[model samples]
Structures are given as structure tokens and as C-alpha cells.
Target: MATEAKRQKVDDGSESLQDFLQWCDRVGLVLSSKVYVSKEGTAADYGMLAKDSIEEGEVLFTIPRSALLHQGTTKVSSLLEKEKLSLESSSGWVPLLLALLYEYTPSQSHWKPYLSLWSDFKALDHPMFWSKEERVKLLRGTGIPEAVDTDLSNIQREYKDVVLPFMIRHPDLWNPNTHTLDLYTQLVAFVMAYSFQEPQDEEDDEEDEEDEEEKAPNPPMMVPMADMLNHVSNHNANLEFTPESLKMVCVRHIHKGEEVFNTYGQMANCQLLHMYGFTEPYQSNSNDTADIPVINLYKAATQGVQSDSDRRLIEERWELLCQMTQDKGAFVFSKQGCLTDSELHTALKVFCMSEEEFSEFKDNEGWEDDDDEDDERISQALSSEGLLELKPSWKQLIHEAARLTLRSYGDGEEEEKVVDSDRVLMEDRAAFKGLSCRQRRALQVRFGQKMILNRLMELTKL
Candidate 1:
């Protein structure tokens, strides 16, 4: 362990989760690919969630430095170049620093979590740094957007979702780094979440005639500790961070053995489902989209467990929980464990799953999008693009399921395409069912009732 890592450790006796991740090799649930897109229906796209209990303002989890690749894919020669420096820090200085950390570490296998950070940072709107010509020269090897000086003013003007906590105490780190070493100066958690982006108003664009479409600020390129809380729209997980240590300190008190969840879809269900790809567990009908509660997931992690599908889910899910917990949920940590793969995977795998199943009981009456035949509201057998996490086969099923449930976009242009009923049925029958009985049931919580209805509706739409 490096000196920096030691300094960042929160060895408060309150935590049952040890300082380092113990199960990286034995675990496969942590999605290794870090490049996740919020909107494009990626592997992170596990459909409808099973209902999990949570309270308002709970500290879902903490970010660990061990899982996060600090300098993110350091191509040393390219990064030093003036042009490519933009690529190194496009998400701000965070990736660049992580890349530096990656540069120093000798052990490659253990560095998966940190290396994954590079992709996440790049996905954000690249922060403008040097002049176009200078940047172009430096950006020779690694393929990314052509380096161009973005108007710093434009960046600030467009800064809501891309916000991060920063300490005014240090100008050096205002750029970005792997850890919070710079912010540690103040004893107090003086750090404030700041953004290179500025605020925007509805009335500011040119021509005033509604030519510009509304776009959200990109998800923060470098979540650092702030990304720990699983994505949830409600304040249930309520994750917060301090600028002083750049550590994401948990403000909400959590009980021991709870699965930590972050605010995954703090935006909306459609946004959450299509983007991160996991459909939150909720009952939806025309009269009740708002009533659909958005809650963060927290699994109760048992102290001991053996290898089994049930155990895998529990362990994988709770790995995030344990890392985020401090001394049995009593205290929260900041600026440490950024490199822990389990936390990174758990955070990345928000609603992600391979399949979901929904069924309507013989007497069940409630359903969504019943009238719209071409509705994409919920559907099956559809394709998705821009989903970065899951493999093509994994996400193909999600796309199909989503198509079955939702209203199709634009005059039924993107509606689900039909396959021969017999052929599809044969395929389902011929293939081996991968999940165990318990695992299948656990997965059904996301796709159970409404999803099945959507599939039935698709038969008519075609």
C-alpha cells in the first residue's frame, strides 16, 4: 500500500467491513467495464427492481480509493504531451491523476477498478483546456474527441449535473487528482461541491424561438467519493461529500448490515431505466407515476456466506454496502477506497441485470400503456445503443423487454420487431436457464407483472 492510501484509511473500529476488498477474484458481479452511459441502455440496464426497504436520508455506502484507477490508463508519453493532456483530464483533473496512480502501481491485475475510471471520465463532456492546435498535437495516440478549446464560459454556463465538491483551499487540485490529499489541509470538511460549469436559465439561448433542445449537464466525469451512494432519485440514500478531504462522508446514519444504495435515478424512471438500464421496483399506472417510489437498494449482508447464486447476489450487492459502511454503519468515510473494485462495480451496476421477468396474475387488472399499441412504455425484442457496460447479448434482452413495456418513439418507428412466435418459444425452450430457482425469483422482482403484459401487447402491435 502507498503512503497516500494509508493516510486516507478510516480505521474507525465501528466498521465491520475491513479497509481493503477481500473478494475481487472470487467475485464476478462487479462489472469490469467502467464506461457507463446513463441514457443509451447499457449493461447497467437491469430492468424493474425488486422492492427493497429503505429510510429517508440513509448513508448508502462510501467510496473506496482501492477500486478506482487514479491516473486512469496512463499512456505516460501521450499524457505529458500538451494536446493529450485534455484527454487525461477531460472529465477534469480526476482521470489524469488516477492515470498517474495507475502509472505507479506495479500490480496490473489489482488495478482493474482504477483503470476503469478512465472510460467514465471520458464519457463526460470533455473539459476544454489548451488551444486547438496545441491540443491536437498532444492527442496523437489515444482516440477521443479532437482536442479543441471549449469556452470555459460555456462550460460554467452549462453546469448542473456535472457538479463536484471542491476545496477553495487548493488551486492545484481544483483541476483534478485521484485522491483528496490536497483537500486534507483543513481539519473541517470545508470542501464544497463545485463545478467547472456555471448555472443556466431557460431564457438564455439565441433566436429565442425554441431551436435549442433542453439537455442535462453530463453526469459528473469524476464522481470520486460522491459517486458512492447508489443512484436513487429520492433522498433515501442521500450521499454527500466534503471538499476539504475530497472524501465522500456519509451524512445519514445507517444501520449495520444494510445494502448501500445511491441515488440512481434522481432524474426519472424513463431516464433511469433506459440510461443506467435498471428499472427501479415500483407499481406504475396512468394515475400513479408520481406515487412510484424511487428508493435506493441496500441488501442486508450476513457476516458469513458460501458460494451460491443467492450468496453471489448478496455478496456482490453488499460489497458496495460494506465498503461504504464505517465501523458497522456508525461513521462514513471520505477520500479513501477510490480504488476498491467492489464499490466501483456496485456503483456501476446500479440497476444492471441480465434479464427480468414480469407476470400479471389471472385476476390482475392494473397495467400501463394499454391503449397505445406501438408504445415503447414497456416492450420486448428491441435494440439499444450507447449502453456501455453489459455485453451485447446481455443488453439485447433488456432492450427487448423495455420495448415490450414502453410506448415506442416517433410514430412507431422504433417499435419492437417481431420474430416467429414458434421460433422464439423454441429458443427459450432449447437454451439452458442459467439462474437458479432462487436467483430467478430474485430477478423477477424487476420484470414480474407489467413486463409480461408489455410482451403480450407487443404481439398485437406488430
Candidate 2:
């Protein structure tokens, strides 16, 4: 019975997709005869694929700016003009959200065919849609939980302060009975999933220079047909914007039957899953990253300092290190499951020194140059061979810090069990369906972080 229901939903979605494509044709979108949108044997339900061999640098399609669904392109602009509504006080997202809401109305919307292509709210797998319990259980240690909370709170506030008042003024456009919180949530989800930021042209930037508050980049937009392309880590297609149109051009040769993919920039599995509702497996993702909370490391470094003077000195040194790293813009952690060389070196140089070594370095106001013997000494201490020479207790502290981070997720035994079970389930298509899409995506993110934490702990052991 459930299987039949699922099939029905897919069929409905396909019909809507066909309607949208037909609408695109009616509006004069120039699509290549060599490619078409259809289901590929991958996780994405719909993706564009090459029907014939295509060379690098070929133009796949071109979408005229007028066909895009934005304040400038759609009926929303006309209605706002008629109503004398000014959205100057609100964020760019406010007007775009209103534009989406306007087009979502069934009888009044001119863009109904395009709007109908979106999946129902229940189909959204974004972490924001997950229950608080699920977030605590799966995302407690990660930054995603806090980010999801902030996004939901902000959107709710926007609806109350901005959208609700506008709807009250325009009763003909929004009937309270039909436009409920449920619909608002769905619209926000669609925008989050589908909106594109129209790149700010250099000419516009020059014009805005005299404005005291530099205007925020032109609001993100919804590009019809263009949003249909799915992402791959190393994609072969690129989206370029001009004064007249948005173009999808091939960056590399696409073999017949291969999916034409677009790069979403370098993103971690966690970010991809949270924002886009899917994750490439760790092995398949070249850009996979693990976000380590640096605060955990700070706590670990200062844990055993007994003397207040000594503690102050250590804190001072740590602050200097942080500023130096920040100046270079290199403090971020990643999924190759390790800290950057600079981060590792900074942490070791700051925390792994004896009082005598630290005092001498401090007297010099920190290492001044690469030629300094003290600087070379600190560098050598961070090397692999120097690991055996370090005090075992200092090494233990680093191990304990990583272990604490992993523990922040949940019980070690339970986390391991869940990760192991999911790994096996992921390999079996039948078993995979037992979990919701968000659950599957969240598990992959958690698993990736755990692997990195384990690697960090191993480094400490060495």
C-alpha cells in the first residue's frame, strides 16, 4: 500500500515537471537537442543528461532574464508597483519570498506551471524541517543544529513582521484560509532549495559606491529550468550571467548518456545535506570537510595550568596565535580528517612548550623570523619524529580533547553502532528506505565528523 502511494507521488511530480518544461518551451528557452531532463539511476529524482556526445565549452541552454522568477521579472513587481509597496526596510529575501508567495496562489498566479514543479513540504529533507529531538540526537555536536535554529527563528519573524502585514493589506492575493503557516514553511523550503544569487555586475558595484551603506548584492533569484541541473563534486558545466541572460555552458566533454552536472562550489557533506538534501559518500566527495570547534582545543590546552600567571601567559600566547591565523584566513578545519598544517603547528607551538621554553619565546615577544633558532625548534617539535620526544602527558591532553568532541555527539558505543549499521544499510537499496532522507543525510555528516575525530585522536597517540 505504501509502495503504491509512493509511486503515485512520483507520477504526480513527473506530470508537473512535464508541464513546467512545456511552459519553458512556450516562453522561448533555448535548450539543446542533444540533452534532456529525466531520471538518472542516481539519488536525484530528476537531472539533465546528454543524449549525444558533447564537447567541452558547448552551450547547453540559455535562459533569458525575463523568464526568471524574481522581483524584476515576475508579476510581483507589477503588483508591488500597483499597491505602492516599498520593501526598502526589509532584507532582499523578504521581497523574493513575497514574490514566491504571490506566484504560489493557484488561480491568480501566471507562473503556476513553474511553481507546481516543487515537491510537497513533507518531501523536504532540510535539517530545519527535522524535529528538535532528531536534531539533538543526530546533530548535537555539529554546528548545523544552531544554524537550523537561527534560520527557522529568522524566517518566522520575517513572516510575522513583513509577510503577514502585506497579506492582510492584499486580501485578494492571499486568503487566510488557504495561506497558512504550512504553506509559508513550504515556500521558504522551496526558496532555500531553488534560489540562485544573481551575480552583481561590476557596473552595479560602481554605481552603489556613493551609497553610504553598500547595498547587499542583488537578492537571490529563482531561475526556471536552470535550477533543474543537479550537482556533482567535480562538475562539467558552469552557469554564467550576462546583462541579457543566464547561460549554462559545458566546462568539459560530456559522454553520451552521462549526467550534466553543475558545481555548487567546494562544500562539505554536512553543508550539502543541510542545504540541498543530499550527500555524496565520503570516498566520492573530494571536498568533504569536518568542522572542529576550536573552543574545545582551547579548553584542553588550559586545563592543567595551576598558576594564574602561567595561565594568563598561555592565554595571551593563544590569543596572538589566533590573530595571526585569522590574518592569514587559515583557521578552518576540514574532512581530509585533520587540521591544516598551520593550525597544527600553531596549537603545538602555543601549548606544547615547557615554562623555560615558553618564557624565552615570550621574552622575544614570540618567534620573529624563520631564521630564529627558537622558531626552528618549535617547528621541529611539531614534526612526526618529535612526537616520541614530547612529554606523554601533553600528548594525552590532545587525545582527550578530540575524544571529548566525539563524546559531545552521544555515547561512544551507541554512535559507533549506529554508524556501523547505517554503513551496511546504505549499501542495500531496500534497507536504505527504512530511514527518512534527512536521516540518511544527517548520518553521513555525523559519520564523516566521527571519522575525523578518530583520526585526530590517532595523531595524539603517535
Compared with the true structure, what per-residue lDDT tens digits does model 1 show for residues 346-384? 332332432131123112321323454232321211211
Q: List TM-score per model, in order.
A: 0.28, 0.79
The CA lDDT at 135 in model 1 is: 30
Q: Model 2: per-residue lDDT, tens digit, 177-212? A: 677766777777677777788677788889888989
Candidate topping TM-score: 2
Which runs in model 2 stand beyond 4 Å of their true positions?
1-11, 40-42, 78-91, 202-215, 312-331, 335-400, 412-436
In candidate 2, position 358 carries an lDDT of 74
Candidate 1 runs further than 4 Å off: 1-81, 85-235, 247-253, 265-277, 284-462
Question: Candidate 2 has what TM-score?
Answer: 0.79
